[model samples]
Target: MYQVRVLVLCGAHPLYTNWTAPRSTFTSLLPRAKDRHWSLLLHQGLPLNNMAIFAKAPTTCVSFLLPGPVIIQTDEASSEVLYPNYQNCWSLREKTRGRKKAAILQPGISKDLEKVKAGVGINSSDEVDFFVLLDNVAAEQVHSLLSCPALKRFAQMIEQRAVDTALYMLQEEDREGIQMAVGPFLHLLEGNLLKAADPTTPSGKTRKLYLYATHDVTLMPILMALGIFDHKWPPFAADLTMELYQHQESKEWFVQLYYHGEEQVPRGCPDKLCPLDKFLNTMSLYAVSPEKYHMLCSQAQTMELGE
Candidate 1:
């Protein structure tokens, strides 16, 4: 029996930087599981950034790559946990570092903002699926603030103009970077696997596969675009996690996402997002079957977000 192991590292922005470095705790943790053939999945840009950091390391480290095939995918979700009420001077001051210029807005931009506000609404689910929703109070506060006409208008404008521009640039950069780093590894594995299997004779036997993803919060939008996550709602802290197991009794893989840590609302909060670490540890041990694994790979292939 092939014992499949899936490990996920979850946290906010900076933690990703740590994982990509040679001397970081993430590297140290790798050896502990080295005995088993491993695969990696980064939820957002974490894996991409980590790879860049690894390349810069002075000492050559072979441990970063697994003996088997490694697959990397990028997830694009927003990292903004606390949506402040830009309409309120005090709130705006706090969030903008008391800079009047930062808080002030132009008229044309404000008009476009109203259109954006009209386009989106808050999520009203009682039991939220991810960790970021844990802070009910904070979530509510943000909701209330965002509901304001002025702030909503401004947010919409920013989303269309500034936010979209930056996200597009980052997404392209990350996608290209991950492909360059792992492309060769993927080709090698695919070639070897194809040769091992007899093409002339159709065999019913299925192979066990391991997979991983690395990505960033912006991954949420990409996921939604690719039809992986249907809910139009943005991802939250606890929402970021890794899903692992088998598909169709033949294939195995992992899906991951990243969210801001502060977005995790505790259970008592009105929104009720779970804790990050607890959620991940729970899912890591979940069971998997070959049929289910095959199904997962099929869906993943259809998603077409990963190269």
Candidate 2:
């Protein structure tokens, strides 16, 4: 059987990190997987300043490209409307134009989570063929605006966008034989991983499987939601990483988590512009091993924050 090395890239920002450590690491790593097909999976967080670099290399064997960063504004009035019950106000506004929403909604968190559970075909006895990846940011602070009542109305809109993006890629004809990669909120990562990792189902039969959670500091709450950590702990102040690698011959996947150095970018994208090639080359050399990369994603459902 042929092995495909899929690289899922996401983090605080790429351009401003000096482009040497992580970049060089990744470059060296990709070529090492000799005899295997090398596929690059670009998640969210690529900077707007670096858009030119990505656009210039359209045919560079990229298996998937998610919509870039988006900004959400929470004005006082909007916040009041969205989080009326909490004695605090919250608002949700798009930071970037033409960006898409994240996931489909189902009334309440329980209901929405139920829908996600169903998507993984959890109840089915047969193995559903797919892998999962979750890209998110870590929210450093909990704003009263996050609890706004008005924001709830748009919940479904956000959920639909995220789900649609994954489903769309899954439906592509060329993707049939390849292992699946599912990206969801960090809070949802543990559950998704458990579901996808279940050994009883047919979906778990794939020889090689992977589930990636990509994000920056905004991943805190979702991690809390997943019970991975607690709110009292400072939000994931540094870059955190995790990996799940399946041994094709054994069908057993090894999972590990790592903490990379702290990144100081505010919105996730880099403050400066760097050529895409330079960045990719850097990634090739600096990419972390499954056991040592940090994860800094969030569970925000809106496009603005989702990216």
Candidate 3:
């Protein structure tokens, strides 16, 4: 059998049924795994849940939501510490073009979006208005709307486009976009891959699985950084898994990425199973070293906030 290490990036709050339901099903399948770690790393806004599967599992204190380390100016001089600044490339995107309707969307799509907004009692003409309205829509109301096949299809399309707008704003060409969006997390993921490939490391020898629980905002940027985002709203419990394998004979290492359950061929890879060196090189484009990450974040100026 191929020796493998698994890493799962979960992007959803467990409080929602949508997140909990699929999580339950996924956990049930691995009831007997011997070497696994489930880290409930979360943003400050999310309430921590220590019960359930995490009751006995250790958790990471690091919040992977930000780029890590903040530089502050004191009365005496300047200092750098671990903290969050809301002025990241991802957050600054709100001040850019994400909130406005893109010129490229077809007129028919615009009409459909307007109809979706109206159905949900949204009076605003903003392109992203429906997302705000839909968040508060009662589950029963959504169920009733989805009961009709046409309405269900329309709902899917609108939701996907709304999420796509958010993704589009994080394009690599944007100022420090990929760096501010996923620098720390990308660095950590690269470290994991490195450790998994080495047999003498503690994590490589003992840990077989690693899980990170986060939100859609964090997940989308990661997907975009990896060049695998499908431009769809990540439904409840959406996850990305990275599997690293070592051949038994030649002992060569390879990587495979999966979104939800479907295998993905990440950009810069020639095949579904990518050699470790090639995968690392592709990811290096988005990865930032600790010193550089802190410097870039310290230089950021806050932009206007919005959806």
Best by lDDT: 3
- Candidate 3 ranges with C-alpha deviation above 4 Å: 1-115, 125-128, 134-154, 202-205, 302-307
Ranking by TM-score: 3, 2, 1
What candidate 2 gets wrong by more than 4 Å, as runs, is: 1-184, 200-217, 223-238, 245-254, 261-307
Q: Pick the winner on TM-score between candidates 2 and 3.
A: 3
Supply the global lDDT for candidate 3. 0.55
Global Cα RMSD, each model: 18.6, 22.1, 11.1
Each candidate's TM vs. the true structure?
Answer: 0.23, 0.25, 0.61
Residues 21-79, model 1: lDDT tens digits: 32232234446666322322332323331111211112211224435544454333221
Give the TM-score (vs. native) of candidate 1.
0.23
Q: After superposition, how far is residue 28 of candidate 2 from its true place, in Å?
A: 6.8
Q: Which of 1 and 3 is the better model by TM-score? A: 3
Least well predicted 10-residue stretch by lDDT in candidate 1: 49-58
CA lDDT of each prediction against the hidden true structure: 0.31, 0.29, 0.55
What lDDT does candidate 1 reach at residue 251? 49
Q: Which candidate gets the maximum TM-score versus the true structure? A: 3
